[model samples]
Target: MSDAATKSDAAMKPGWTPRSAWAGILSEGSFGAKGPAGVTATAREDLGIASLIAPEDGEAALSQVVKTRFGLDLPTTPRTVVLAGRALVWAGPGQWLLVTENRTGFASDLQALSGLAAIADQSDGRAVLTLSGGKIRTALAKGCMIDLHPSAFPVGSAALTSIAHIGVHLWRADNGPNGAVFEFMVARSMAGSFWSWFSASAAEFGYSVHVGRG
Candidate 1:
């Protein structure tokens, strides 16, 4: 069957409304004219995410498959690696999360690692949030227990932890004056609660809310 036919049939099938998990909480909001001193918050919806579990001692083989196919290396504990169009975050021992802009066939693509790994689609199960700017770490520190100091969680690092009591997969994507962008994935059902906590934490330094594509 053609890809178009598959897509058409999926669309024609009955389903619930495609509203964002953060539809009610995200929008144009700012504390001041310039918004937060040095912080910008963006929410991206419908991103492709998959959970990968590689067999014991198969991390190397799995990494090879990822590197060959996606041009990215499967990161080890507490790290995230980004390629031209995809990113891989270490989720746990022998487990990783794959993120990409295109959700189509993502989970299937990992079949290259077939005998060595297992894949599960989490595209609709979570929401992506990005926090950037000079004071971004400060804002995160308000509600998160993790040490945001550069010496500790440097750029290209990832952590599976909780923020404001909400579980999340967090990672630092960059570092610079206008850099230091951190991307995190939170459960769809907890997006609203996370937003509430984020807002309160960012209030002191002010903040801007951005909706739509990340």
Candidate 2:
């Protein structure tokens, strides 16, 4: 007997369609020991994302345009402002990531503000997932380095950090009946890697998964 096999037989193979890379591995159901669910994960594949870059020394002008257009005061720090189903999330100095369901509408609004800031669609390059429930914070803590304590990363808080070496933008949304709410924004290429770490982290408390229709 030899370890090598003849070419006639193929070893077990793993594959994914160009767009549905994570689909084969994830099922829409609960995993781990069953009990009262401590976490729920939902895909936000339809989300329209874009980067808003303020022109040099045009911060004030950018603020005015965003204010008049979306009735939003651009977040100057790491925070999230939700208005009319859209979130203006601060990414860094004079930069923000806009998340919404209607990308065309959002792009139009950005056009109204483009005179002061640069707008680029980020939808295709980003992967977003909404995570919620009682044990979210604890599960997140397993791989995230930041302090998730309410007093530290309270609701509306957002940050660009890493999980298992994968870069991610983590943010805390309003609390839900189950408990806290949060979302992760990661590069499309690393989504599978990120989820692997997340699923394991969440398994201890029990969790559910929902793949988006998109």
Assess candidate 2 and give its TM-score to the true structure.
0.86
Give me the overall lDDT of model 2. Answer: 0.83
The residue pairs found clashing in candidate 2 are none
Q: Per-residue lDDT of 45-125 in model 2, one digit per residue for the tens?
A: 667788998878999988887788778889999999988878899999999988886565765766676667788888878
Show where candidate 2 strays beyond 4 Å.
1-22, 212-214
| Among all candidates shown, the one with the greatest lDDT | 2
Q: Which ten residues in a row have the lowest lDDT in candidate 2?
A: 1-10
- Give residue 193's error in model 1 in angstroms: 1.0
